[model samples]
Target: MTAAKKIAASESKARAAEFPAKAGEPAVEVEERSTDGADGTRHVKEFVVLKATWPGRDEADSHKANGAAVANEAIQRGLHPRGEPRFDGAEDHPDGLSLTLTYSVDTVPSSVDHTPGDTTTPRDVLRSEG
Candidate 1:
């Protein structure tokens, strides 16, 4: 099944309880990403962007709210964004600075296909130090 289908199906039981998905509302993927430091030492950050829609609402607005929700959850779990927390002009709680989640709707036939510009950390690069 597609991510949206999976999310919607699971929503019936539980899916971001604080921000439950309304009936017929597809789950928009929210991601927090960071670049490989332009100087190869410090990463460049950007505001969180949504990759899908939230039923009948504005996609951008939905993204802002969902992104903020994700941030709040991360903070509660003692996790932080990949860089300094900054506002992205989103009017969500705390001004939508808690999290700058981004998303890339690049999926394969069976899984999520995150491309170079996708909002996902390159763990392999970080894991290799030699």
Candidate 2:
């Protein structure tokens, strides 16, 4: 079987059942998607998100590795696990420092918009001639 076919088959297996959510979070949802592969075949990709937290950088890295392991396990269990586990970065929240990780069964492109916000203003410069 081609790489695309293998990925599709894996996604199908993962999506065959539901994965229970973590203790405090909502149930995990599996999203079915198809994207054009390099060889022109549309491959189905499954994705889900898992969360982890840490108080410091060392802990965060450890948690991220753990999260990746969990994500891979999800794939083995047919939970539509996507990607090789990604650390979505850490943020400081009222509760504590937290990280949002994404796992996908296949790679996907990402886009970012950089247009300045309406409320943003240019700062004036004080000119000093040489």
Candidate 3:
């Protein structure tokens, strides 16, 4: 499990974290804070990237629609790579038709500056009689 902070606005930010996976549990799960103590809101979103291949042009082409569908949906959901999704590789599977597909996910939160306009009093650094 990993945690990160993403800055959304000058006065607000989002803290996104993932839960550790246990035996037989989902691999990725995101935990987000919508509202912070400073009266700011944060939204945590997740998207999916699909890469696949098959034997011959016909078989490989068959999955184009499905591939596009996922990327499109991810875009509508406010994920990264908005319009152009990345492809793992561009190669023909004319070789015995062996192929592979991989999946990954990530997110981030914010750091500091939660209350930019707030003020604080300074304390003395030295109070010594050693």
Q: What is candidate 2's lDDT per residue for 1-130, written digit by digit as tens?
A: 9999986676555445342122111122222322211111112222222234233356545544444554444344334332333333443444443433332233221111123131111110011110
Candidates 1 and 3: which is better by lDDT? 1
**Backbone clashes in each candidate structure, one number apiece?**
3, 6, 5
What ranges in model 3 sit over 4 Å off? 1-13, 16-53, 56-63, 89-100, 103-130
Give the distance in Å from residue 85's predicted Cα in candidate 1 to where it truly belongs: 10
| TM-score per candidate, chains pooled | 0.24, 0.27, 0.25
How much does candidate 1 score in TM-score? 0.24
Once fitted onto the true fold, the runs of candidate 1 whose alpha carbons sit more than 4 angstroms away are 1-53, 83-130
lDDT of 1 by residue, 1-130 (tens): 9999986677655334432222222232112122311111112234443323222386544544444443333333222323222223332334443434432211111122223243222332223231
Clash pairs (backbone) in predicted model 1? 31-102, 37-42, 48-101
Error of 2 at 8 (Å): 24
lDDT of 1 at 23: 29
What overall lDDT, based on C-alpha atoms, would model 2 receive against the true structure? Answer: 0.32
**Index of the highest-TM-score prediction:** 2
TM-score of 2: 0.27
